[model samples]
Target: MIEFALPDVGEGLTEAEVVAWHVVVGDVVEVNDVLVEIETAKSVVELPSPAAGTIATVHVDEGTTVDVGSALVTIDDGAGAGDVETEDEEPLVLVGRAPAAAEPRRVRLGASRPSDPPGPGPVIGHRTDAGPRVRTKPPVRLLAKRLGVDLHTVTPSSGDVVSRQDVEAAAALTSEPPVSAVADARETRTPIKGVRKATAAAMTRSAFTAPHVTEWLTVDVTRTMELVHRLRADRAWRDVRLTPLVFVARAFLLAVRRFPEINARWDDEAQEIVVPHFVNLGIATATPRGLLVPNIKDSHLLDLAGLAHAIDALVQSARAGTTPPAEMARGTITITNIGALGVDAGTPILNPGEAAILAFGAVRDMPWVVDGQIIIRKVTQLAMSFDHRLVDGELGSRVLTEVGRLLSDPGETFLHV
Candidate 1:
């Protein structure tokens, strides 16, 4: 029997919630067939069977969050079935809250060290005589034990004491109605997991760590709007998906190319600036799951039509929750289209590990001074927030200037392309 442990589907994701199972005990499955869907910090990923086999056991129930090496299922492929075994280590026990003598040790399959606990939540339960005791009521302690939760793993919602609600909340990381979640119909409680949880952590880290500087520019984009209409009418471009966003994406790419230094990251570890020649342009997309910034790889290499198609496909996949984890990695810079929701402008936070992010606001008809004459023109606002450590105000302003110039007169910008 092959014991299938939960795998790290995303980049170093320690745990994932078992969103769904595609097979059950005694069911036949083929190699590469999807066995389950597990949601990591970034996205939902489908795990495929490693070997053709009959499902022998589903160790983890749906809605449970399991560590990367925790046993998820067992499959028998005409091979001998045996008891699931653990690594060469002591039987796992909950630290701070020792299990009773009669209770059996729950062995996590791939646990290497006691610190590497194999269950779920903040810290998995493992045998250790160290660490401060987590304060909780006896009934809450019993509840944690029954649900296989470690008291040390649950972060107390209020102060130091862990309540029954905290225990239940830990159990329902990805599933179940949050116990005592409603004090009244006036309020609702949602378990922070999957995308939402990850977004909060990332945004917090970015907001506090990076010294951010924001710059704004307003430009008349009458020519860019005219170009969009012309492209829609053109036979060659009729089939291509085009929008103001596509133009904005193109303009951002051009600006980055002009100022390659802007497409760099501050490597604090190495104490150096790391710049890549290639640009993985990330588009901030709002999905049902959450905000996903799945990027287009080598966007600098694609032409206008190709970029439009890529942008459309990326947005559609993100909204449908089908974007792969790899597509969301290694983003150098980003663009958030707040205009899609009719917002004027926003100070977009820099995507973690990125140097800058641009916010594109709604394009509207506004009075503009052209040749010293006030007239109505298609205008829009652009705002960019950049890491002040890597991007000085002058460098950031120059990049924004180029982007605005390109968007204001895209026909001239394309002439060179």
Candidate 2:
């Protein structure tokens, strides 16, 4: 019997919630056969079988969060199952939260060490006789990265090169993933004018194409608001503008470290989900031209003070109507502040290609329960919408919950800040 443990599907993902199982005991499987769909912090990934085997026993129940390297299944591969080496190292992640140094590992697809000789052509920088033979675009590379598939193993159906269809076919094992955005010219079209033409057309295409799922959570942030007030009086923050949004961004960044998948993109053309190591956090600003979401490049690398300064610069440039065109594009995830407009919360449409968008509602004085005492605490609502195709309910809920948790008790996030 081969003992299979859960692998870190996303960078720094220590555990995953088992979303669904495609197999049970007594079933024979082949290499790369999908065994189960697991929701990691960043996205829902289908774990493939490493060795063909007969039914044994599944160790964990559905919806249970299994830690990295814990045995998930015991498969009977018969007598022919060779001496497979078990991984003994911890998950090494370049981005997001750094994995614990002593965490053990298990058998997984594309398992290899940095010192190990690289796999063949089909992956990023796979070399051919001339140099590298993989003829796929960035989207295909992104898809392969997310699926954890080796490009060298994928055989393209058409042409003398690997294509998106080939990668999707190899990974999804189902029908092709739908193209992300599609715009149609219709008679009921709104005129090609200002924001309606610029924003509506693009957003309509995103809404119709991407499968969006939004989750809401109400959080008590009285302490968080108080912290902001305290920071404003500090000499370190004297030059920087400290606002609730800055704290919200900090909390969101802290959550991203735990749930990195929220900072991902759906490369529809590449036909796969893309998880970025760095966070290009988009701040949604209402402007005279239209609703513009200019993002902070490498926001994850910045500290709390740096984030506040970045937010100030981004908002200023946006409101001045001098925000560059490049800044408006390439947002991985977004944060929309509805409280500024006197709204609590609203379902937000995702910026095109981004996997998720988070909405921060108005924080106000509300009656709250604190240690069995009735008190007025600063409360707020957080609404999050993510692509259902990439993110499931479990993943979405955990990310939103983490954000709310940090806000409700931000003292825990000081270590990260």
Candidate 3:
């Protein structure tokens, strides 16, 4: 019998709330077949199976938040009723078929596991006195239990040893979560597990640890506002959602190129400054569940239109809770559009692992100095917070100044290629 344990989805996610199960016991499944859908900190991911066989048992009920290495399902490879090594002491084997049953349980969202507390737990799998006995690779281990695959009975075809394919093969033999489990309750709470929990802890640590320095500058972005209006009226941006945020993103991207040091991270471990050449632009979005900063992988490579589309897609996905785990990782820079909430400006917190964050304030018609004369112009404030460890006052000021310049005179500054 193969035992499938939940894998780390991404961003160090330890456990996830089983939003759904696509496979059940007695069902024939193939490798790469989606076994379950789990909700992590930032998104809902469909976990694929690892092995091909008959699902003997499902340890977790739908909506239950299982720990990372907790048994999700058992797969029987029809290897005959002989001596088999199973995680459980019962030592079950691949016998004939059996009738399926349902188990109901409640799960909490954003909650921690009992065994793995805030501090420490098993890194990959549980360790016993006998020895280390995890069946899958790091990635495969993450995929196994997530897809509800049993690893013990899974045959590793790869000459190199256990791979994600083996775990996926084991998952193909299962059916969806039981219908009775779905009807058990309309609402459930899953404690934050895995990446979600880790993100929370990191954010909390950063918030309290960093003595944040926020500086705000209100600029008369009449020209930028005019460009947005023109773009909206143009046929090129007809389908796209033309908003100030798009221009803000573009401006920040360009400004980062001018002041590259701001687009870096402080590595306290190595006592070094890590600067990135490319930009993974993160947009802070408020979802129904919580705050998520899903980013464009390579924002530097995208044009204004591409950036707008990417931002739109990311925001929509985040709000719907469908953003992928991969999209939320490796962000070098971040932006929070606080203006959407009608706020003028805010001292936004920096995302962990990144050195700086830009807060785009609300764009509104306000009296401003234009050519030394007071005039009603489209005005907005830009607030920036940077890590003092990597970004000194001069670099932060230069980056913020460049962004202000671009916004104030977008026509003069060329769009970042």
Best by lDDT, which number? 1
The whole-model C-alpha lDDT of candidate 3 against the native structure comes to 0.72
Tens digit per residue, CA lDDT, model 1, 1-417: 567777656676899987656665545666666777777777767777665656656777667889988988776655444564432233222113322222122333333423223566332222243556577653355346546576788899999999878988889784543332433558666567778888899999999999999999998999999999888999988899889999999999999999999999989999999999999999999975689999999999998888988999999878766677888888889999999999999999999989999999999999999999999999999999999999999999999999999988777575244
Count of residue pairs whose backbone atoms collide, per candidate: 0, 6, 54
Residues 114-133, candidate 2: write the lDDT tens digits.
32235653332112233343
Estimate, for each residue in 1-417, the C-alpha lDDT of model 3 and write its tens digit.
Answer: 567777766767676777656655445565556666676666777666565555556677655777777777765545543543344432222223323322212223223433223575333212222432334433344456556565555677866466766766667777643222232347534445544575688788888766577788888899999888888898966988878899989999988887788888877788888887889999999875578898999898888888888999999888766777888899999999999999998988889888899999899998987689998999999999987877788888888988999889999353446
What local lDDT does model 1 show for residue 237? 86
Candidate 2 yields a Cα-based lDDT of: 0.70
| Candidate 1 lDDT trough over 10 residues, lowest sum | 87-96
Off by over 4 Å in 3: 81-199, 412-416
Q: lDDT of each structure?
A: 0.78, 0.70, 0.72
Give the distance in Å from residue 184's predicted Cα in candidate 1 to where it truly belongs.
3.2
Question: Which of 1 and 2 is ahead in lDDT?
Answer: 1
The list of candidate 1 runs beyond 4 A from truth reads: 82-183, 415-417
